[model samples]
Target: MNEPCSRLAGVAVHLPETTMTTAELEDAVEARSPGVRIPRGVLERASGVRRRHIAAPHELPSDLAVAASREVLDDAGVRPAELDLIIYAGVLGDTVEPATAHVVAAGLGAACPVFDVRNACNGFANAIDIADALIARGGHRRVLITCGELLSAGIPWRIRSTEEFFAAGPHYTFSDAGAALLMEAGPAAGDGPAGGVLATRFSAESAAWALAALPVTGLSSDPDGAPLGIGRFDYDSLRFAAAFNDLDLEVLHKPLVEAGLRWDDFAAVCVHQAALPYLRAFCDRAGIPHDRTVVTIAEHGNVATASLPLQLAEAVRGGRVRRGDLVALVGLGSGIGAGIVIARW
Candidate 1:
């Protein structure tokens, strides 16, 4: 049987102008946890991230998505009217009432079908999978997949414990960014990209779901008491880090093997930017070249669902990726979910 096929038509990305450095994060963490000690250099050396971009106080996910979608359409020479579908894949939403996709689509002047995919950090890969399916089914000629993450909004400023963790090196590294990819059916009458969608795989260890959960607990206040919002990261996140690290390898192996390829077959691998330590451990276990693995966590921290696409966009913009290269998009995050998509671009 022939493999499925899909092709990337175009790509574009946007990063906020504001940046937060490792030292700044450390100071913030220190202020929250006076006794906690973390070496700033450890963050940089381990994460390969020097700084991360953040949105302004007034900016929302839809705002970033609009900017990014425009750039992508312009680069692809595609007009808003030409888009058949728009999928916003990210954890952050413009509002709890209305889907952020509607707002972003309107902002982009797109008068087409629009929706969202919430798969945490793996959202982009999941979006790609959905777009590919639509093209395969001949239901859509062009599908626009966009992701926007505003991770800073979730930070608890009031709680010293939560505040310190946000101030920690990882938090400073966390950034706000958006990315868009234009995907269309392959040149031939096939479901896969011309080069082929070799294989796609996903895995999850449900028992480990609580590893990186955000519980809706009461606020943790800074020196000046103020009501910090709900949803704070559980410090015990470190405990499940090991489980995710192990799952990363398990997830990649299945698709790779089914595709009759090895880790060395791909020119580059785009994994979710969870954190510095977990990423390193995954790389070491997989035996994939660390240099080939794109790192964004140190700078962008963990952009939840937007991380993978943002990393892919960076690699493309930096000229690190080119035509006919075997690229892997791997996603791992809450839900303890992990997915892999092999793409030829």
Candidate 2:
């Protein structure tokens, strides 16, 4: 049997110092939109987000990604020159051109190939999937995946009406953060209770793309056919949930079962978390052990593509998981896409 060719070497996260509680977001909503009657504690009850971090005024997405990438690289004792590829997979970038990966590579003084992979919240996981294949091809030896999400900056502050506020509530729970993962090519480890990436599967439901979106492009105040204006967030949590509920993850879970791994077999399971309730619901529905997973949405809000890596970092920091343990990564994103990545720690 062919062995797994790539392994996750290190993971790191960087969260902005400033934080805003759900209560504060509600207060701001009322303050910004005097006409909108926002009942106190509503956002907190609905989203289950206690607070989230906010980036500094001068902070850019690349800045956060660079910080995390540097930390992970340093932690693994890997130098910038040793990297073969740098992929920035995040929701936002420093600018449209030059690719966010270029900024990250520039910060690391790396001259290797750099690119961007944008797939909503699934960006980071998608990069991992692609990097794993690249390493398997025997070309790239070391790959760096980074994401710096400054979603707080794009939050819709000015509310036109109560309906508009609720439709855009997902924005209020967003938090700014940066995360990175390092992967290296190594001797093959066959699919089993061994180290390295064991299996991966990705699925998409593009038909549900309009369930949630934010049109914050700094162009014409509002682009044609766009969902909202500057800082405008449009979301429908109910429909979003329904869409994902319909998403078929059998392909994702089949390999794990075939490998004789159950949910309890994992030392830690990291799933993309948007809200506390949604996280719990998804876990319950998927039969995932919630106790073995780190809950970040309640305290950290939704960190977008950084969610999985942050959970892994938190688990490692807390000593809940260690080397040689089996772990699983489940990714659910705004594209209504889902993916599964199981590996040995």
Query: How well does candidate 1 score on lDDT at residue 82?
Result: 93
Give the per-residue lDDT of model 1 (tens digit) for 11-102.
77778888877667656656776565555576676556667677989998888888888998998899999989999987777865577889
lDDT of 2 by residue, 1-345 (tens): 464478889999999989998888888878988788877787888889999999999999999999999999999999999999999999888977889899899988999999999999999889999999999888899999999999998687888888877777788888999999999987686544346887888888888888877666455455555553355456777888889888887856787888888999888999999888888988888889889788988989999999999999999889988877888899998877999888877
Model 1 per-residue lDDT at 260: 79
Query: TM-score for every candidate vs. truth?
Result: 0.84, 0.92
Q: How close is candidate 1 to the true structure, as a TM-score?
A: 0.84
Output the lDDT of residue 69, model 1: 88
Which residue runs does candidate 2 get wrong by more than 4 Å? 1-4, 190-194, 215-231
Local error of candidate 1 at residue 70 (angstroms): 1.0
